[model samples]
Target: MDKENYTAWDSAEFLTDDDIIIEYLKAALEENDPAFFMKAIGNVARSKGMSTIAQETHLGRPSLYKALSGERDPRIGTVMKVLAALGIQLTIAPRQA
Candidate 1:
């Protein structure tokens, strides 16, 4: 099945554990630390399936693997591409700390 064919259930009528988890990860990525951002995204990619996510971002599976595996730091454009593909939005706000 194509990953793009799958839709995230944000609706109250059909929320799944995965949906909640994804939301948490998305929220956590809002932290000030870049490491937190990377880890959150990596975790989500693993749960969502790397190959499917790669296809969604139009990035190659090998490239996604390298980025998420921490072997390399993805460029800002790459990070934005993956986040957008995963339906994650990053927002800036005042630091809680």
Candidate 2:
């Protein structure tokens, strides 16, 4: 099935609070769930505007889809590039209980 055929809610609801979204994303990273990470990336991309992100990262739309959707394993640098393109700043925090 095409990814575009699904809505954001299909995987997770759209997180309205940016801070909460970031925190949830941080926790997901800590858990190391590739699917969760991909979902977070997709949510961020959807919230931030995929086309604009693609343009800013100098990546084609299909490339963005593959990377963010986990169809391909992108390098850490590439993931950072995409996050930067989406105007999101990543920060590390001590593991939480």
Candidate 3:
């Protein structure tokens, strides 16, 4: 395939619907990788407009990006704030045995 024939793929472009976003996050959670989960959250946030999420979460855009870059372990409070801004709620369930 010619390089010019293909456009880069971005998950954020397809995360427009709330249901889809929820499912995407759920899949990320199933990965059992904290970094992956954070990246997933970042994708959802970008889909919703990072500026808006920043305002809602009272966090700077740069800080938000760094926290969600999947390179650092963000605090639970920070994760909670980001999730809340994305209109998502974290719930607990018993692990399957």
Best by TM-score: 3
Per-candidate clashes, comma-separated = 0, 0, 0
lDDT of each: 0.70, 0.74, 0.95
**What's the true lDDT of residue 80 in model 2?**
87
For TM-score, candidate 2 versus 3, the one ahead is 3
What is the per-residue lDDT of model 2 for residues 20-45, given as tens digits with 9 covering 90 to 100?
66876777777788766866787677
User: Which runs of model 3 end up more than 4 angstroms from their true locations?
Assistant: 1-4
Estimated TM-score for each candidate: 0.64, 0.70, 0.93
RMSD values for the candidates in order, in angstroms, are 10.2, 5.8, 1.5
- Tens digits of per-residue lDDT, candidate 1, 1-97, equal 6556666753322323666766766566667566666766766776667788888889998888778654567798888888787776667878677
Off by over 4 Å in 1: 1-19, 26-32
lDDT of 3 by residue, 23-76 (tens): 999999999999999999999999999999999999999999999989989999
CA lDDT for candidate 3 = 0.95
Put the candidates in lDDT order, highest first: 3, 2, 1
Instruction: Sort all candidates by TM-score, best to worst.
Output: 3, 2, 1
Model 2 stretches with alpha carbons more than 4 Å out: 1-13, 92-97
81 Cα displacement, candidate 1 (Å):
1.2
